[model samples]
Target: MLAGKYSTLGAMPTERTFAMIKPDGVRRGLTAEILRRIELKGYRTVGLKLYQIPRETAESHYGEHSAKPFFGELVDFITSGPVVAIALEGENAIAGWRSMMGATNPANAAPGTIRGDFATSVGENVTHGSDSPESAQRELALFFAEGELLK
Candidate 1:
């Protein structure tokens, strides 16, 4: 379900999207900076956590890429360290976060975006965001238990 606090503009429904600060972001101590940007964008953080990703969970999370040769590497790197999982609610959150994160590869990202500012490579890009409403629901479910996020 779409979730968020009401906007002052009157009943403008906001959507919930799942976002992540990858291991590199956490290790580099960019969590606060990243979160600050999120809040500045007017997105409400419904839930947040800091933890390590389990192997099985990582596999499940990247299941769609299982057939790709890089799947195993993806799972390994993500599970190697702690990550920050965030549930954000805002107008066009899915698209907004993606834009804010910039391109998957830092090389092609805009100068003001997160990846562009911090990432040096595509494999260890700083952040992750749900690409669509359906993916948002699935991802949010994987990381959060029912009622865990403020509504």
Candidate 2:
């Protein structure tokens, strides 16, 4: 399937999940490996693209974290290089991607995960996944224009 818009169960796929490879992932050439894992998990990629996030977009995307000390660093890191953003469809995909991504800090992440396999620091965790369904929808809207990623 191109972008997995649903699962076999036909539960209507609660909500879409959004994921993005950080600058480090692109610089290290881990994009294929990361996408492979997502495909292997049986989820469908509804949308995929390689683009550099503008500073404004990055700021809005991480706006909730603006008050945090690392917010500026987060924005800068995300905009530092090209990133691959994906829209995934499947049951519980938001949570699933988060699990697949492991912990926020690679040091705490379990082995056999994308972060565990490639990341070395919390700031460069390699990928970003939607924390909730609402955010997933919001983020999908932010990164993908209408019809940009098909189901």
Candidate 3:
């Protein structure tokens, strides 16, 4: 199990978020650093796995971006390499993960953030994070099943 900083109780019941270390991040050998940050931020890694998603799965995962011109490219990029999928748990985990991820475009991310620290290009941004509670729930469901993420 991954180490985490957290309290037993809080304003929000223990929440969950889905996070991914994208291909570029893994290729750059930043997985441990990224996981360290997540742990240091108080989110427990309830579930973790390294897997290469098939093209169809990648397409379905990013289906919200299907209308965008970069949809095909996005799918290709994601399916081209193995990714680290994580289910994080803690109070406000969804929001916490997003703040840690910074902006979608590394150039727009603030200094000291994960993207700002390691990413150079928007398309090769190092990570993926759930944008909202609804998104977190939906994404978690897609990546993890019941009993997959433990307390």
**Each candidate's TM vs. the true structure?**
0.92, 0.90, 0.89
lDDT of 3 at 131: 85
**Would you give me the overall lDDT of model 1?**
0.94
Output the lDDT of residue 139, model 1: 94
Question: Residue by residue across 1-151, what tens digits does model 1's lDDT show?
Answer: 2345443546446899999999999999999999999999999999999979899989999999999999999999999899999999998899999999999999999999999999989999989999999999999999998999998
What value does the lDDT take at residue 100 in candidate 2?
97
The number of the candidate with the highest TM-score is 1
Q: So what's the TM-score on candidate 2?
A: 0.90
The alpha-carbon deviation from the true structure for residue 115 of candidate 3, after best TM-score superposition, in angstroms, is 0.2
Per-residue CA lDDT of candidate 2, range 63-128, in tens?
A: 999999989999999999999999998778988999999998888899998888899898888999
Higher-ranked by TM-score: 1 or 2: 1
Candidate achieving higher TM-score, 2 or 3: 2
Clashes of 2: 4
Root-mean-square deviation of each candidate, in angstroms? 4.8, 5.0, 5.3
* Model 3 per-residue lDDT tens digits across residues 1-151: 2334443334676788899999999989999999999989888999998978888778888999999999999999998899999999888887778889888888889887899899889899999988887888888887777888886
Tell me the whole-model lDDT of each prediction, alpha carbons only. 0.94, 0.90, 0.88
Candidate 3 overall lDDT versus native: 0.88
